[model samples]
Target chain A: MAKIPIQVTVNGQTHQAEVEPRTLLVHFLREDLGLTGTKIGCDTSQCGACVVMMNGSTVKSCTCLAVQADGAEVTTIEGVADQGNLHPIQEAFWDNHGLQCGYCTAGMIMTSVELLQRNPNPTAEQVRAGLEGNLCRCTGYQNIVKSVLAAAERMGG
Target chain B: MFAPEFEYHRANTVAEAIDLLSSNPGAKVMAGGHSLIPLLKLRLARPGVVVDIGGVAEMKGITIADGNIRIGALTTHWEIESSSQVAEANSLLAEAAGGIGDTQVRNRGTIGGNLSHADPASDWGTVLTALNATLEIRGPGGATRTASPTDFIVGPLTTTLGETEILTAVNVPVLAANQRAEYAKMAHPASGYAVVGAAVVVNVDGHTCTGASLAVGGAVPAPVRLTSVENALTGKELTFENIEAATAQADNDLGGEILGDFFASAEYRRAMAAVETKHALFHATEVAHH
Candidate 1:
């Protein structure tokens, strides 16, 4: 099989590569594009560490083929912060100590941004439900939940 | 951790997808990459070619007319869950969609992929069985056919779909004003797949049970209709005690080999089959559960 040429726009920048059909999107982001902010905790798709925004929805990048994103607009954790300023969700995570080891922070923040975008005034249970895809092994999820709530309040929604 | 090498083809229409399937003998159709991608990574499924129908413009979205709801094959689970048309027409399907794998999985999983994979625990199988839904299938040369849930699902991870057939859409009669339906399940803690999912549709004129249709999944090799329970409730009044009594006979109606594993033993799943049926019937009838 020949390498398939795909053009994907990541973090508002277009990058073209001739990737194997089997190469996963996360591998392309972390290895090909050198955007390692999106960690690959479980390459089997169990862990949401490779979560990224595809088009307008969050998808597990580890399960997605790089070729499948031929013309998709992708947003990685590297794109969440504006210039040097952190997004409100990132700021809340920083203020609330949302990370114990910080392994799951990128995916958590991305999923939270999507959740808050859809439901700006979500309750604690809703926040928990929305973040069900991303798993944190260190924290018991109390502070992570708190971080999302704080972010929700600070964003005034 | 990645799928083995395979040729890839993108289909723009159902006819093109059928052409790809017929040409590539061992190709698999990928819709949302939720079910197929994991299987590929796990090496549970290996194909020489993969025909991605995700970009097919004709195979996305939901439409309701002629007293029926038609859901395109590529319609994502999230789309079905959040669709007001589905909720108003068939709340059972909508609720089951909302609870299907977590948020991201639901956002990526599609109805066609879910049904074609035919996982025994697939909630769509059980719900569509009770609803008597029709599965539209298209083959090469514009050949077409329809199969009900019972006929479509052959066994675990198997369906009646031919190698050259593409599941185009799912058609289900809208729930009438006199009918109520609900799907109740005991989802696996980690994956959220059903352990004992039951879907029930009951018709009541005032208080008398005019008719009932029920099916159980997760605990069986395929979705099994609870004919005994349906017969038990058909002529009786729709009361808490009546629903309980009817669903208690669920075991007598469960057909095929019972499914079990370490997480849920055969005996446990068998018992929960009755319990979930009762719960679904209770919820459908608005009967209070103690």
Candidate 2:
């Protein structure tokens, strides 16, 4: 198979490369770009461990083809923080104990980034509904909801 | 999770996409890739060439004209879920889109891909059946045609759409002033696919049901219209008892073998068909003699 050329901007960095057509966006981010922050869980698209921001919307990278993301702007979990400064969502997650195993934290924070962007002042129920795509088996999502709420308040929502 | 190797082509226009498909017998059109990619990774679909129409500008949008609403094929579920146009045109579509999958899936999953994939448990088919929506299809040499859900979706993961045909748009009639519509679903916990989904559109004249259209999916091969129940609701008062009596006939119209999996059995789904129908009608006619 011929590798296709795709120019994707990941976290404000543009990289032009030839990738196999079968390469998914998550693989492109983790393997080709060597930005391993995006986790791939339940590669069948059921789990949102591979969730990332593409053109301002969150999508399951495991389900999206790298070729499909040609010329698009992508933001992985690595891009969430600003110059070693934790984003408000990340700080809230930490302060609120949103994670126990830390496996789903990256995806949860990424999803919260989009959710809060969409709804600045979301209720706890709304936060839970918005994060339904991402699953966390250990924490039971009680603190996750609280983290999102706490983040909303921190963002002056 | 890698799909089998295949050639890839990005088409800028629908004509180019059509040419790509017509030129290769083993080619498949991918819009959004949420449905097809999963199938590909599962080895359920193995096309020789994959034509991506994700960036095609001609196949994306939502519009209303002449008392009808037109949603382009590339319209994502998130677009429908958040669009005030869709909400005003048909709140059922917006609500159904909101309930489909999750935020991530809705953000990227295209309506064209969902209709083209035609999963048995997909919510669009049942909601479209209730809306009497028509699917717009285009083939080689500018050939265009339309089909209802029944004619378009023949069975589970099967459709009458030709190999070279591409779904261009979904055309739905705007709900009338007296018409009430709702879609109710029992979504699977893990996958978010409908375990049993029901959609109802009813016309009422001061609490008297004048006409009705209802469909149920997830329990059958494809969305099945409950004509007997539609008849049962006509000229009847909108009451919980009447709704229960009417929806009890859902199983009668559900012909053929019911699809079953570990999450839900055929018997359970068959029985819930009426229950979901009642839920939908109750929602459609909410605050009406409840």
Candidate 3:
């Protein structure tokens, strides 16, 4: 297979590399860029464990090819923190105990960030509907929904 | 699971995409890659070349002309779900788009890719079939053709689109002031794909049904218009008894073998299709009354 040159910005940093056209964005983030915050639960695109922000929209990175994201800005879970300070959403998740096993937390939090960005004042049902893509086997999504609501209120929604 | 090794070409225009498709044998077009990428990763599809049309600027966005809402082929599901034009013009289309997969899938999946893939459980196909949407296809040498939703999908995961043809846009007739449409579906709990989906569009003149279009998906190899139900509903009062009586004929027109899986059986799906059709018609008639 021929390698294609791709330039992408992840976590506010630029990285230029040549990758196979078959390389998925999740693999590129975890392997090539050493950003393991994005997890790949189901490569079949059924699970949202590989969700990431691409060009301001949340997408399952496992389904997105690296070459398809060429020159696009991608934000992973690692980008949620600011200079060693936890983002408000992260803080809300921690305070609300939004994680049980912590495997789906990164994707859940990343999805929540986008959700709150889109709808600043989301209801509990709205939060549940918004986070439908990211599944959590633990906590029964009670605290997850609470965390998003708290985050929204903390962000002055 | 990694996709098989294949050459990739990013096309900037529909013509370039067509050229790539014409030049590369067994090449597959990649829009959002939500459907094809999964197939590629699963090794269900192995192509020599993968034409990436994600950057084709000309095949994106939503517009209205000639009393029709023209949605570009590359228009993402989320865009359609959120579009005020779609919501106002034909809400069944928007509702169906909103119910497809989940947020991540909808964010990355495009209508053209969905239709071109022609998955049997697809939500758009049923809604479009009911709405009588038209697909604009472009092939090599700048040739173009239009296909109705029913004619575009021939079988499960099959479409009338040729190898070198690109679905440029989908044109759906805007709903008339006296008309209303609704979509109801029984989605699989895990994948969010429809188990049995129904879409109904009704034109009511002072509570009397003047016209009706009904379609069902996920129960058969391809979405089918319930012509019997449509005919029965026409010229009848939009009442619960009439709607139920008409929707009971839903299974009469279903051709081919009914789809069955671990999630649902053929008998169960057929029964549920009738139920969903009634629900869809009920909601549509309610909207029409208001």
| Predicted candidate 3 versus true structure: per-residue lDDT over B1-290, tens digit per residue | 79999999999999999999999978999999999999999899999899999989899999987789999999999999999888988777788888888888889899999999999999999999998888999999999999998899988899999999999999999999998788888999988888999988898899999998889998988899999999999999989899889989888888868999888999999999999999888787773221
User: What are the fnat scores of the candidates, in the order listed?
Assistant: 0.85, 1.00, 0.91
Candidate 2: stretches off by over 4 Å? B287-290
Ranking of all predicted structures according to DockQ, beginning with the best and ending with the worst:
2, 3, 1
Give a tens-digit lDDT track for model 3, residues A73-143. 99999998999999999999899988889989899988999899889999999999998888776645999
Q: Is candidate 1 or candidate 2 better by lDDT?
A: 2
User: Chain A only: TM-score of every candidate?
Assistant: 0.97, 0.98, 0.97
Predicted structure with the largest lDDT when compared to the true one: 2
**Which run of 10 residues does model 2 chain B get worst, by summed lDDT?**
B281-290
Ranking by lDDT: 2, 1, 3
lDDT of 2 by residue, A14-122 (tens): 9999999999999999998899988988897777888999999998899999998989999988898899999999999999999998888899999999999999999
lDDT of 2 by residue, B1-290 (tens): 88999999989999999999989997988999988898899999999999999999989999988889899999999999999988998899899999988998899998989999999999999999999999999999999999999899999889999988999999999999999999888989878889999999999999889999999998899999999999999999998889889988998899988989889999999999889889889988994422
User: First chain of model 2: TM-score?
Assistant: 0.98
